[model samples]
Target: MYVARDCYEQGVKDYNSSTNPWLSSPLNFTVSSTQNKFVVVGCDTYAYLSGYQQNESYTTGCASRCESTRFMVNGSCTGVGCCEVDIPKGLKNVTLESRSFQNHTIVENFNPCGYAFISKQDTFNFSIDSLRTLRDQQMMPMVLDWAIGNETCNDVENKSNYICGGNSSCQNSEDGSGYRCKCKDGYDGNPYLSHGCQDIDECQDPSNCNCPGQECINEPGKFTCFCIKGYHLDQSAGVCVPNQSSLQVKLLVGLGTSFGTLFLITISLVLFNAIKKRSETKLKKLFFKKNGGLLLQQQISSNENNVQNITLFNSKELEKATDYFSENRIVGKGGQEADRSLSIYFLHSMEENHLLDILDDRVKKEGDKEEVIIVANLAKRCLHLNGRKRPTMREVAIELQGIRKTSDGQQNYEELQFSRSEEIEHSDVSFTSTGSFSIIASTSSSTVLPLLPFKTI
Candidate 1:
């Protein structure tokens, strides 16, 4: 029971339990002292717990006082900051009220409110912060003793109104009123209802298995543990052990274990190789798609006139020819600067009979210088800014073949034939295949040069 008072306003409140109905049922309801305790929390607080037992009145109280918060220890209810007292046995109803010496005016800034309650002992732990605020919660849980009626267990054993069901037993309450029902061993659940008690299967719970590596046999309300086949209980080791048998059986077991290990290792190696091959195939496909291989193939197929001798060098071949793109192998500045410089250098090198320096030295120098100059000039013309000023690569290829025929016994390199002159309608051009250009001719209305590094002049 709680005593109501205006804690937010200044006043002297009277304490009384006359309005509480709990006092009228003292014989049937007893306050549980073991389950609950009286508690009061505040800096300048005092609380009282008064009750009646067997027509006699009993009064007890506790005073909690603290000058500062330094004397408080959290989770403890001593007389310094918070206080707790155990209720007396056989006390049925109790009333709780808070009192202060000076209306908490001395420590009003830190603790203006006080709280008093009879709550479950296990659930109430004092905290120093509660002195400052209570968060609008004014009540706590309390336990009350309950029984069927005023009767001993033996007196109600054979009565027609006895509520204890099958598989249940009755025990006289400690308060001397009635009896409480409880299920028997190996059973659980509410005992007051018909068929409420149910058998417990210990073997069904994995954690209940006291015997490891053994067969657990379940029975009605009980279970048994036994060793598995081919094993016997080793009492000293407290575990199952294999039966001591002939040496031939042991030899076969060892052989089987060795075979299993080898089989696992073989499977692991096969899977490793399979994963590696799959990754490599996936990487090759990615590289091909990224380099526009399909687009190149489509262009080559469209050139029905002269697609012969067209070659697409793989990465390994091009890397070798360019000396792996080492700094020394680069002829000029990279990008557009290099593109322009390479075209000029190619023409100059050919006119000066130094063409072998740009091309592979492996090429035969037996070719005529006049034929080389004619082909070089045509490539240089393709570098024109205006396409109309430049002869298309097709026209250049036509002239290049005529010059090659004049130098008839020279070795010829395989070359790529362009689809149309429109493909070369830009100022920039790069023909890199095996790091050297090749010559090929096609009879088309458009002009384009094959195998030579060229730009529209």
Candidate 2:
């Protein structure tokens, strides 16, 4: 830090008027605004101080005026005789000018010379007697701002010239240039030297732990408190104790534990039900897709005009109809019987037409025998082992339609026999057949079998 000081004394012949100029070493020094002020003391004294900051020149001053010493107030410089003003920040140089407004003719007998100086604020108190006897004083104390350089905290932290020591942190200067050092939290002392900052033992302070008889453990930067076994803090008393016979405490603890156990059980049950419901839903979806539900929906959609409604059987209904999809409920072999009653009805209708046995009593003599024979033959062809030999559903529909137009039912039966050369004797079609009847399809490599046969009366 650098300070510039000068004084104006009485009887200095060559120095009647004084102008003190303070110049800094470029950016190294500045007049501290926090610690210094511009001051003037004596009757009819005019003082002006000028400085340059950030390339802009500025000036300020104070004037002291009084006719007699009786008008001056001791320890007060409110412009009656002595006056002062604060200095601006970042002032690199300053010039002080002192002048007399009245030529000192009125007060020179009592006050010979006026004094002006820049010094620490509030350091000087005006004395009414000093107006005539202050010529012997040489200099006044002032403060200046100083730092190592213009580098910031971050710029110095990684460099060899960093000044902050261990347990310390760097702080950028308030002027936005240079930096300073200070001890870190939980530590104190000089931060510019090695191992200067030391830890503070917070356990020494009894106020840190509210629990009387609790052990206070001091850590690196903090402290903790713990009670002995079976003892707890009584918050109202701010101390540790064991209340072994309090009914209210026992009741509170019991209620808390009961509520906690009930809460855990409730949560467990809720989670278990959620997981079970999700698993069941997922399994149902998988079964729906596997049982060709999508294909059935597509087919029903395509023929929506002919099929006015599509009914979907849920898992439970299907399970009941197919006897849980067990082999015991299926006729003719291992494939599922989706609707056991519907399958039985289909086979019974075929038997009523004399497809499996003698013709039904109602259709025995009056019904068209040739048409019945034609349908029975077609039904038998559907049970063919080779899929290529079976007629497609479209072809079967066309054949049934042609039977309606035929004058002779035998003609349609012979046409079906000519269309497919597969044999269908009496033994080939029977109600007592046990295994599944494989279909014959010309276009499909995979053969699906019919799983039902019926009883005839």
Candidate 3:
């Protein structure tokens, strides 16, 4: 390196050395550009490096200067006393030339010469001692990069001539001019030779299986540690640990018992509620039939099309409507419909010749007297003691229609006749003294001592 700087006072630029790595036959290698640098070290020295490249020539240069050694740090290359330029990749050759100013005219006693060269980056140390002692060492070490063939890995990867043997992978040279071969993971050897790569017995190495006092078993490309009975491998720690099967079984049992108990309680509550509701519904239906609810429903159904839509209220509905039969709501049998109704009172009044007295004051004042008497007498026939003597709803309707047809004439109700007819529909007229109901339903009703108690619900 000193040869390039051994020159005149002003500047002398010439090639003082040449270095190349490919000259070593059978294993041609290139200087590792990534691992080495073109370095220049001196005060009042400027230098550059030149080399051949694939696309063009490559050149790099650097400069360093320091008035006194005290200003330069021992190992720092900050241009105070040392400078460096990076080597370009794929540089097969390195040449150094230099320019010297003052030529160490002042520091010539101790720092006699300037130095420039391509040295391995890791091995070079720039100390103050290096400035005076570097020349004593004539040779320097550098790293080199190597590969297998001139063709890239991709170009010959599948070809028969591919040099990578078994268990080896091909790698392209960093410079893009060739390729290299390396053993596959877990195998190591010269990958360029057939069967050169061999499996590494990791079990033999103590660091591979860190399970102390345990047997280590080797397998293809890897190893495992054998655990004793009632133990399992702790994957994270790579050690044998006691199994927790007993604890896990206890936990599962506890969870199952709790869930089953809660589930049974829930099912029992639901079943109790469902059975209670069903039994109440069945009892309600039984009482309804016992009270002759069937005949009431049939009568309603038969009359429904000919009159307004009808609604039948259950016991609960009726109780709610009258505020559970509060004493304040009681007026007469008409208002207290729990059992007897106005029909009973009306029949009693008619039998005693007190039909007119039972009529509402407003009805007596506004109604035609003849119609009142006719309707009252009809009601008397309807409440007849013999069920067979009672007129059908159709016959009742016919007689009522006949009364309406003859309303304008001076009616003679004293001679009114009773006759049965087959073809007359019932006429609905004011029956209830108050409320929206057309009529009241009674399961047991009669004023006259009857042949039987009729269920008229």
Candidate 4:
């Protein structure tokens, strides 16, 4: 490293610049001038540079002139506002001085003083503001060329004082006054001491090779690339690529496709079930409207609290509502009844012991007399006026199966149920002007059970 003693009294004129010449180092080299430039900064001044290189003296100077800043460029140091000259090589001691051509009488308003220094050419640039101040800069940097005592490489290569280390070589200095040592190619370090040069591990940087899939092998001061298993280097692409035509790759692709297909099927089934449930709800609503259930619902909701719309119809009223057994209303073209004016008649047949009378002769054959009486008693309990007295479903099934013995006559009882199922579908319903609802259920050919509830359509 080389540093010039650079300083300037901002508003003063008398100053001098010089570098330490008596300094010594392990390599025994002095300050170098080969890498420095003699720089002069002023508008109407001249700067001189004097130095000694290997006992040889030299003197050089450059003059700068600029009237106004209008045409001055900042970085151009070509005799405008700034000027520079290459320093002589092998210079060990330097002195810089400056003098104003007209005592700064013309450009003093813009450039009050002049300056001269030794520095790297790139380290200094002239700007308009530099004329006013330098931001208190005191030191500037330059490059130094180092070498051993005054001797050529051949004069000391084989002597006991030779200093070139392993993997290094000795070379004469640029000024031809001394010699220097350097590490050879593929090696680097201080080359003046024993074992100072070391091999460079190029593999530390993988970019030494263009292939990433290949393994980087580090050799002494060098590197090589080798492909790993399941990979091969492609000459055209200049890179290692994995084998795509392998069974493992095919297996992965097949598994991905199968899972995707199953996901789609599961989604389709979920959508199908949602549509089916929505359609069922819509159908039930349509059937309810067609059966006058909407009007029945409105009548029930509009009634005062503790009010009900259900009305029971007697056997005579049910027969009238069915149009006295007209064939067209039963098994032919369906007709809507318009003559609907009915009086409520809740049946109390069990209290009157009229059980056998409600059974239709067309529906029931001559079954056992004992079974008939047993059935009549069950009906009385199921039809109890107080709902709390009514037998539960479990008790009803137990009583029917326990009280009666199994007989071939059971076939006749089943026949009676099947024959009346068709007649019970459209038994009879009547609505009065007061919005009273009456329904009669035909359990047999002639059996009429009043106020029988049915499930929603």
Per-model TM-score, in order, reads 0.49, 0.43, 0.46, 0.48
- Give the worst 10-residue stretch by lDDT in candidate 1: 13-22
Where model 4 places Cα greater than 4 Å from the true spot, the runs are: 1-34, 52-57, 73-79, 121-125, 134-139, 229-457
lDDT, candidate 1, at 135: 29
- 10 residues in a row with least lDDT, candidate 2: 435-444
RMSD of each: 19.2, 26.3, 22.3, 19.1
> Can you list the residue pairs that collide in candidate 2?
332-434, 332-435, 332-436, 333-436, 387-440, 387-441, 390-440
State the local distance difference test value for candidate 1. 0.68
Alpha-carbon error at 361 in model 4, in Å? 28
- For TM-score, candidate 1 versus 4, the one ahead is 1
Candidate 4 residue-wise lDDT, 179-275, digit = tens: 8899987788999778888989887875776565688777765677878777888989878888766447768889999999999999999999999
lDDT of 3 by residue, 114-177 (tens): 7777788877878888765755555566677777667887799889989888888988888647
Please provide, for model 1 over 226-320, each residue's C-alpha lDDT reduced to its tens digit, 9 standing for 90 to 100. 88877788999878777776345787899999999999999999999999999998998898789787777877989765666689887799899
Candidate 2, residues 53-125: lDDT per residue as tens digits?
A: 6568879888888898887789988988788888787776777766777666667677767777777877777
Note the Cα lDDT for every prediction shown.
0.68, 0.68, 0.66, 0.64
- Clash pairs, candidate 3, are none
Which RMSD does model 2 reach against the true structure? 26.3
